[model samples]
Target chain A: MELEELKNLWTELSDELEKQKNLTDKIIMNMTQQRYTNKFEKITRYESVGAVICFLVAIGILWKFEELDTWYLKLCGGITLAFLLIMPVLVLRAIHQIKKLNILELNYRDTIVAFEKARNHLLMIQQFGIYLSFVLFFTTIPVASKLLSNKDFFIMEKEFSLYVLIGVVMVFLYFFARWGYRSYKKITNSAENILNELDNGV
Target chain B: MTKEQKFTELIKDNEGVIFKITTVYTNNESDQKDLYQDIVYQLWKSFDSFRNESKISTWMYRVALNTAISHLRSRKKQPGGSGIDKIVQRATENEDQEFEDRLKILYAQIQKLNVLEKGLMLLLLEGKKYQEIAEITGLTESNVGTRISRIKQKLKSRILKS
Candidate 1:
């Protein structure tokens, strides 16, 4: 089919669509009455729960400050506490960037450029998240052990079991980070391919 | 008329654009509805910025295209996220088998185009000129011309092969 034929087809569909005309005034009002938010609500809610959990965990660790005895345990606690305290800001900022997109601001602007910048912003957060997984793995083991069972792996009499546990945690963190990176790539590869297509002139 | 009434009227007039853009951007059934509502919400939010009737179509094109390309597709059918799934289905329901088949083939071809090329081809198929396509897409007129020609050739070859 030539472009003209395809266009005729498109116009035929358009004519049919015009005849249908079923977006009632009530539906439009329901959609645009400051109640119908965008498609990011689920993930934003997920991230919110993640953030709240982080904040509460940070609070719990801070309150149990005295339990983290010894120099190394204190160091782990501090690292965990700092990450838990700071992660929510990074997360919520990314969520806010997505949720609070003002279309008025994008009117007549270079849209592809804006989209690239937004994707870069989201990727940066996800990149940070992958790195934070490593931080979480190392700090979480020590802090969690102390908080949950007071089993100080550092001062425990046995060393071989600790090695096995470390190996298991290492594998876990590897899979977790891989999941994060893969998730980010899945979301971005579509846009990336589009930009590549534009640049490649194909 | 009130601004809300005017916006509603304008949107009703251009709902076809919204419906078509949603289908172009999404292949999933539910995602199309979600995107349709999202574009409507955005157009409503940005209505004040583009009240010039002379260029309203251009403005709508810009908003719709921008929202579609930049939309992050996710699962959004949860309760309270939106109550418009049925609205979208009913709004887009077509009973004619011939029209449905033609639309499927058209969408299949459109889905084959790359994202930028998809936008350019859509504007072209909608009969937008190079300069207005330039205005809506923020591409130079020459760039739009070159890309549209390239897209046409690409489509021609694809359709011929098929």
Candidate 2:
């Protein structure tokens, strides 16, 4: 095609593209909203599972030392159990606030944005899990000691061993959480780089 | 100018760039819409980095072509049959004698080229110089000349037979 002919063809194509811009923008907007919603839901679900596990742990500890009758012991156990049960519910409610949005299948840029948002959400949840595990680990010692003292249920050596076991588990959890976050960060960064290249027209 | 105003001006001025790339790269209504939107979104995301180094139109072309090439590569791995088949079928069914039949034929032929060849022909069709084409395509100057000559001959024979 001659230069003029190519220019004319491009002009026609440009007119068509202009007409479609509003529609494209709407689709991208929807996709972003949906991505945020999906991330919120996934994070909520993970948190809820964590909360349930904490609740079960609290119940097991209580059952193991039924002989503990002090008011202080009862108060501490109840407060811990209540916290375990409530935190996940709060996270789930927060997730529900995330809006659902549409993503156009053919739009590669929008698709990349959606994927990046998802990866970030996953990393955030992983970090939250790590933080929660640490909180539980540090608080468990004093609570466990109180219950044991109230009941006179175990020798000092046995109580110390239990604390050591809990410490080991906490350390393992911390390392695992850090690894998960690092892997997710790497993937997200690579994906973002590809996105930037596309944006740069490279 | 405000960012929104600048964006509006860019769209108004370069709408054709988006359209031509979409038209050549996609065959159907849905695919056309998809490609068009993808191009615009990419442009919007990259608008900040456009350092006035080259003509905006040239930058647009490079981005559009790169995105189209990547999309084509990914689509090739999809399990279903080729999407171009539907486009060919649609063109055959369109009985409008007023439409440029030669243009449709040219598009069909262009679709058959490999990704690199398609990029070259796309630039060639746009009347870009061999040097500019080499810069965009990462091919040496002589290689670009040889490829364009070869492509021209091939297209001429195909047109003659048709």
Whole-model Cα lDDT of every candidate shown, in order: 0.75, 0.56
Predicted complex 2: CAPRI docking category: incorrect
On TM-score, the leading prediction is 1
Candidate 2 C-alpha error for residue A166, in Å: 48
DockQ of 1: 0.46
DockQ of 2: 0.06
Model 1 regions lying over 4 Å from their true place? A107-109, A157-172, A186-190, A193-202, B51-54, B75-95, B160-162
lDDT for each residue of candidate 2 in B1-162, tens digit (9 for 90 to 100)? 876567666765665555556656665556665666666666666778878777776666766675564332222311221233322222245443323443454466667654456677778777788877766655667878887777777766865776
